[model samples]
Target: MPLDTNRLEPVLPWLKFRGPDDRGIWSDRHIQLGHTRLAILDLSPLGHQPMSFQDGRYWITFNGEIYNYLELRAELVQAGYQFTSKSDTEVLLAAYAHWGTGCLEKLRGMFAFAIWDRKINQLFLARDRFGEKPLYYWIDQGTFYFASELKALLALLPHTPELDPIAVDLYFHYQYVPEPLTPLQGVRKLPAAHFMTLQLDSWKVDLSQYWSLAQIQPLEGNISELIRAELERAIDLSLRSDVPVGIALSGGLDSGTIVALAAPKYKKVLHAFSVGYPGSPPCDEREQARSLANQLGLPFHDVELHTEALVEFFPELMKALDDPIADIAAYGHFAVMRLAAEQGIKVMLSGVGGDELFWGYDWMIEAHHMTQQKQRQNSISAIATTLGKLAHIPIYEKFAVTPKLPKPVRSLLVQGLNAHLIDNEHPNQFVFYNLRQDFRSPWYHRRSLYSQEFLTQLPERNPFHPSVGNDAAWSDITTHLCQVLFNTWLVSNCLALGDRTSMASSLEVRLPLLDYKLAETVIGLQKQYPNEFRNKKAWLKQAVQDILPAEILNRPKRGFEPPYASWIQALLDRYKDSVVSGSLVQSSFLNRNYLVKLFQKPYNNYALVYRVLVLDTWLQNIR
Candidate 1:
């Protein structure tokens, strides 16, 4: 049971890009902690991690910027606490020493850190409110191991971890594995807004939640003013860094809002970075971004992502992601960060959470109304509606449904076309809303695409209910849907992509809109004015209208999107062999015949094809 220093060596190599500034390891009787520091707040040796406090009663290794540390330090000082260094790491230790786990409530900005309480012989770990940072942990044969990246954790494990069947099934359905479950058997991610404690004496672990979107209640005030004030404050705090900060500018309102509010307040010349395609295709936003930068008088830098570059780096991008997520926007995210890194920018601000926080996506509202209509149906009405859909499908199929209609739209039309469909009010009903078209279909439908062997391997339970629990009230369906989006797509897909791609370049990306306080204000405002949210970012636009240019404000919303149709075809052409006889088929997780057909006409079934390719490519790369 003695601590093994050698076990920590392999992980550092895998995570060196995330924290290249410094490296340290600390160990005692049965404990060893390792850290590689990026050194954003304090670049001195005093800011090194595996940092200790109170003559070593508490030692800590932290990742992420505590933007509000200065404010917290003053409060801690008033409570008779003192610090040796100006680093947030010291303030974090002192905060924990004084407040225990209560310290999580007082801290702001993104973070994932652990405190080793030598006095109690206990170890404590916590992730930020929105999971802006990553933490993966595994337990085996009485040993607990954790790291910032899954590959790092894999290197530290005693043996090779097997692919988790349930995780694979969920990944196929959701395009990414939801939290508390990773792709490997026996390995899990710590959920966001949560903390854990492990006592060395008994080796017992306790996990608890510190925050939830559901905890926010409706606020009463000038809603626009409240939101504007919170946003400015959040951006102001985000700009508090010793290193140079840049903005991930885009053509849309979200990034424009950040630039409008942040450029003036930034202490030095604020740089703007953007990514576009070679042809200046309609999807490219570089021109808009360049115009904005010119108007603001900020230096602008942009990169063109040729298809060849994306194809060449596809495998490395998959590996850098560390988790097999099928999102195509990752290429853009990686390019922008790499551009920023090249400019010597250590930290960047992004506008990621706007769509999820406000009612930005119009389809979200449609999904909410559709669920309500289904809930209000009586058996007779349900039967009539089901039959109407069935009757129209043949007629619509003959004339309307083309071979290239995109499988998602087809799946959406055919979803819930089975018996006992009236009882679809379960949280699983919202799966289609989040782009998981075939997740909750009847067994007959699943059997067509997934192999019987794979179907049998899956447990007889709803995969989504674990993450999207049915505890929230269905009456407030919109809020419930928003919460589900946050828990599922927003965290696993959007935030995960941001953290992984940015950190791959060893740069820190901060999302001011995702600040917990700003999120709470928006959610609370939604509760008070539910009708206002249905109008799609009405309050958000109003709050930032004065600062945002009218053209930028009114421009349609298309976030850092790539030309998916072309990119997917290019990826398919490059990795088609994987789909024809790849990991999913060879392992009997997907039916070979179905996969062959899907691959034959990739356009029709691009979603499923993309997921299969990503998984197969990932399995191959890791091996």
Candidate 2:
């Protein structure tokens, strides 16, 4: 029997969610596509999507917001495009009809949408420049499947997808699987700034690049002035919500910048949400966030997280996540979204793309320093000698500098040092190691699992090529960061977590920072601009200077990391049987003894622990 649309009903249970009170899944046979709405703009019946447009000539299931819709609508109206709705979706349809694929260039936002063009008998699929929104698809026997979440696609597909063991290895090294590959082998993520048009008759999917971050160019202006103008524009574009809009304010620079830019424009005290834990050092950014909120005169809410909350929410988190991502930050996001829904905020803005766009990550600095240092070496032999010494130090201790070395000397010594930072364990191997450690008496033997020939042949069998090659050190920061951000963090964690958590509450979250125009412009910048991003978003800080407080401007970028290590240790002590004795250890997927060793060591491997706990909880629930 052909797979009925009715059978796809249980695939996306969260799409039927309305407000906070009623959140669950539903199925429909008549509708070919299902949507899990975030409700970012025009929070009316008119704005509801998987929406029919232009006298039902076209229907769209869109996952992201178009920030410049109002401006585009004004242009369309002038060009004789009348509207039945005040939705960006309608505006997008009109733009598509008028300009075809060219419409993508005229619009600015982070988005992924599937448009059914009735006249053309085709399906149009697209993802934004930096891939802030995810679009995953699986094509089999002339039937094409797609969804904002990979799990949704998996739910609809007839066959159980095979695990990509190589991807499992990549996940261990990168913490998230790089794009174009999912945990499942058959499913694939659409690349950033690209689109595909599927012809129904022939069942052909033609992919093309609508935009590229490589096209960004350094603009000639005062560095601070340029930063201010572009950032303000980006914020203004993101603030295009028709429903009540709010910010996920953090002590970090990016979210602070967003709050500062948006607060003055908001009529009432803007509702800001944050998350933390009681008495956790790394988790407490509440005081700084509170200070900024006070300065801006916004109503701020901080939810103190508890271990029980994490345990209770673990299964839901796993279900929302398509793959077993090791990034523990997803839990923090899940907590925040729960709080956001409780406050009745339909759409919340996040500063997710700031680090990728503005060279905000320490990796960028380290990569740059490493590249420069390698250049200064007299010979390849000399460079090899330095790497040999660094390799002698334990991988875990690599980040720490000798205490006797002066700060400047230490910086110089570490500058331009490039090596594979993760302990040489491959991703699948690491998973196996972690699992084995969890099961046995917390003791495991290490062994070289794969032969050199086996390792060499792995990539050949893989569907998606690794974004950064084995030999590629981070020589080019701009391109490298763009690839890493899009392929790894944005796809694997940020958008994935946001989609799951927000949809669980029937809320939509929008990211303006990942807008195509903004991303392209930032990526195009000269490598030497704004003094090498030494301050990490130094230019962005200058751009929003007038709007942001001086104190906030100078603050370091503390990313959205909760105190998972401390919480996990506490959880382990209290619920040792639940975690350690669970199926996670028994499964052949991870090395359980290594996990025990990780826990035994007095270090912060909170992310690793959380991964095990989440997997443990998930396995327990499913079993």
Candidate 3:
């Protein structure tokens, strides 16, 4: 696959951040394959990508490490496949040559790659199971384009891509565009666990799902032991890298668990990086991260975040993200990744997926509690509705036994009054509703800040329409809601931020908790013993109880976010005019008057302020 001088011109900017080593391009009239090497594995010319097999039947331009390459290479070796170099790229090519699409099921680790099957004149694209990596594609006027970043794919186009209105709608709803939808129209995400095949001549497309997290069921064994074994195995496999690997350590249970497990097998100093804010509240995890690092005999590295730094680097943060994500926490990840890269570390494992897998979010508990109260209220409401229809009584007349209840429960009941019959509503739907309304700050609360035209144009989209499965929990609704949050919130928003920010520094961030095997184990444990899924990450806590100190395990949930209040205030103090008078407001995507009011008033919700400012910064930098 020689570099086409024409295509190369537009793609050079993308190569600047990633391809520090030799760049390889394999191009012909029919197809073009390009790669920028980071040289993590088999750091030699042989590891150069756009790699092909001896017969040149399959060619791949891949990003990410195959931690199981050695094991896969061993199996391929016995099957009589010869390798020219000890590169995962070669193992990947050989495995594909032998097993075809079946090879994906046998591999582990984060990856997004395009394989050109010259034998069939087709292109096959696949992403890892948990979307630890992102692959975006656009189909335009008979041409198919895909890239690791939207900016990379945009480089190949002539004119600027328009902002997708629906995506902008979702960005305001969830602070990020939900997957299968990018900010640009015509572009779509290659969702995790899915694959696509394109016929070269006809340009016909076929997409398929190769794996499903819903395949989980109750396992017949001690739940804690099973989780411990599965997770330890994932860590073992993830730590198999040629270059030094580091840990994105924090005070939380997840990263602490990874460090405890990998400390023995890492075979190096086990460098850990943490982010802190200068003179801020006790939110920063520097001291806690340092304590854990000391207990584990690992070296600790950290960077202190300053408000001015976040304000000045605002646009670069959006550029690093390649898309707008309203999460202020991404800044923390960016700092740690930068620190790791500066120390010459290429690979790092993060503890990101545990919450999604083992039900670690605060909303999970809150949703369950709300659901219990709703069950009691609905029981009374259902009887009243029946009486109202039979006796011409008002629906609320008798139901007004009017017991005083908590505000959260009363608010949900009021919202559900005019709602359609939810008699058959799945537990997951209820969970999704409770979480979305309770956890998410929808724009209806800030409708005054939106233009009337924008309000009318806002599509009535339910972001939680995707299924996470509806069985095995006490009710189908419970687990279904959990899975929705896992996919929509964790994988798409959280993991997307992790990939973009880390890759912006040419650093690879791995998640052992997202290991399909480990995820399956947690889901199975919940299904098998539904009653025991009571505590947040309870199984996880028990699994590593012997390794993690009690203090670390008992610490309250401090999520992966720096002190954003002061940071947003600092940013607003410097750029309030720039945002209030910026394109986002002037274009009517936001209300100029409301923004000015927000700036002038003593706004308490600094997070909401940060989100809009981030949006404005992105709108400006994108051009």
lDDT (0 to 1) per candidate: 0.82, 0.64, 0.76
**In terms of lDDT, which candidate is stronger, 1 or 3?**
1
- TM-score per candidate, chains pooled: 0.93, 0.81, 0.89
What digit string (tens of lDDT, one per residue) describes model 2 on residues 547-606? 777777887777667776655676565555566556645644555555556556463555
Evaluation by TM-score, superior candidate among 1 and 2: 1
TM-score quality measure for candidate 1:
0.93
Model 2 shows how many backbone clashes? 31
lDDT of 3 by residue, 186-227 (tens): 878998888899998888999888876556667668888999
Q: What's the residue-level lDDT of 234 in candidate 2?
A: 78
2 or 3, greater by lDDT: 3
TM-score of 2: 0.81
Better TM-score candidate (2, 3)? 3
